[model samples]
Target: MMTVVHHRTVDVGGQAVFYREAGDATAPAVVLLHGAPASSFMFRGLIPLLADRYHVVAPDLLGFGYSAMPPVERFDYTFGALTDAVEGFLDTIGIRRCALYVQDYGAPVGWRLALRDATRITAVVSQNGNAYTEGFVDSFWKPLWDYAEDMTEEKAAPLRGALSLEGIRWQYTHGVPDTSLVSPDTWMHDHMLVSRPGSMDVQLKLFSEYPTNVALYPQVQEYFRTTQVPLLAVWGRNDEIFGPDGARAFRRDLPDAEVHLLDGGHFLLESELPAVTALMRDFLGRALPV
Candidate 1:
């Protein structure tokens, strides 16, 4: 039987937030937060798979996918602001507690939620969602790091290429042993939305503020140690942006943290969906039982 997935939108702080929902609302809630250059659309495959056992909700962050893209002037594009929107969205929708599946940009947002109210997060499943200083690949982040130190058009100019169609394509294909597994639709869809007027600026603003997430690594690790929230790190071992070190680092804080390094790249779902889904089902079953 096919699990029915619903596409819906709701108002969160006057902004139209779009989300994909599945399974019964009464089931244990599992919230999926997508990374950069992707939206709830990234989880299209995973949602249905998890819906059979868990109530799954994947939302497009304010500036990504079908969600409202308020200009930088009106909305601060920092991760903190994004986290606020997600927090409010959860409150408005009555998801008091949920297991968070975070990736890339979603890490900061999800971690921030955990920081705000430790009781709200039932478990954490980080898929290339980094929260450690050692997780970053210097070669990949050097340019962005420079831009962070000196916020200027010149510094930001070179980084804009990353949001280009070609760059987005590379993001999806890179580190994957078999590029054929990555669908063109993934990058094309991302490029279309990212190329929108002022979208680049919005992305850059978030990029510049990424260091803030790095700064909070200690606090996040502390939460991991003290609260000892259920944690599972299912990472793409070949991801260059956030290497395997980040995944293994989780064990430093939570010695019992379950870590699985898969033979895939950044967008593991594209190449290893079944494997990832199976791991998640097992982990969530143990952490947040139905």
Candidate 2:
């Protein structure tokens, strides 16, 4: 039987938070959090595959996808604020405990959720979701690093290019050995949302506060070491934004963490969906039993 994924929205602190949900309401939950420039849409393929065994939920974070985008002037665009919104979303949606499938920008948000309430997280599945300094690919991050060092319009101007169609397309195709495997729709959808009016500023505001995430790495690692929560890292070995080292670094804190490196890019699901899906199924089956 084909699992039906539902498109829905809920009021999270007065904001209309959009999400995709599937599987049984009574089943164990798996929340998928997306990266920058993308949304719950990225999990379109993985949701149904997991829905057979687990209740899968993927939310479009505020300022991304169909979620309400409060103006940067009114909203604090830091990871902390994003986490609070996600926490509130989970509460409003009645998800008390679940595994977290985090990628890119979702890593910080997921980690914050864990920090705020470790008891609510059953396991973690990180796909190119970096948390350690070792994960950084200096070349790709230098520009952002420069901007973070000096928060000025001049410094932030160059970063806007990443919001362009070409730049967004490159993120999807960059490390994939076979570009044909990637669907054009992925980048197109992302570019559409990211290029929306005022979206660039929202992203920039989040970018400017990225340093805070890096600073919280120590605390996150401590949580890992202490909690010893089940963790699986399926990384795109060729990801230029976050190298495989970041995936391996998890072992430093949680030696039992499972790490797998596949040939792909930052957007591993775009090129290696099958492999990623299989790994998640196996990991979650054991880590978060139904």
Q: Would you give me the overall lDDT of model 2? A: 0.93
What lDDT does the true structure give each of the candidates? 0.93, 0.93
Model 1, residue 233: C-alpha shift (Å):
0.5
Error of 1 at 102 (Å): 0.4
lDDT string, candidate 1, 1-290, tens digits: 98899999999999999999999899999999999999999999999999988889999999999999999999989888999999999998899999999999999999999999999999999999998987898877988999989989888876788778898888788899999999999999999999999899899888889889989999999999999999999999998889999999999999999999999888899999999999999999999877
Clashes of 1: 0
Tens digit of per-residue lDDT, candidate 2, span 1-290: 87899999999998999999999989999999999899999999999999998989999999999999999998888889888889999999899999999999999999999998899999999999999999999988988989998988888877888778998898999999999999999999999998888899899988889999999999999999999999999999999999999999999999999999999999999889999999999999899777
Give the RMSD in angstroms, all C-alphas superposed, for model 1: 0.8
Worst 10 residues of 1 by lDDT: 155-164
Return the TM-score for each candidate structure. 0.99, 0.98
By TM-score, how accurate is candidate 1? 0.99
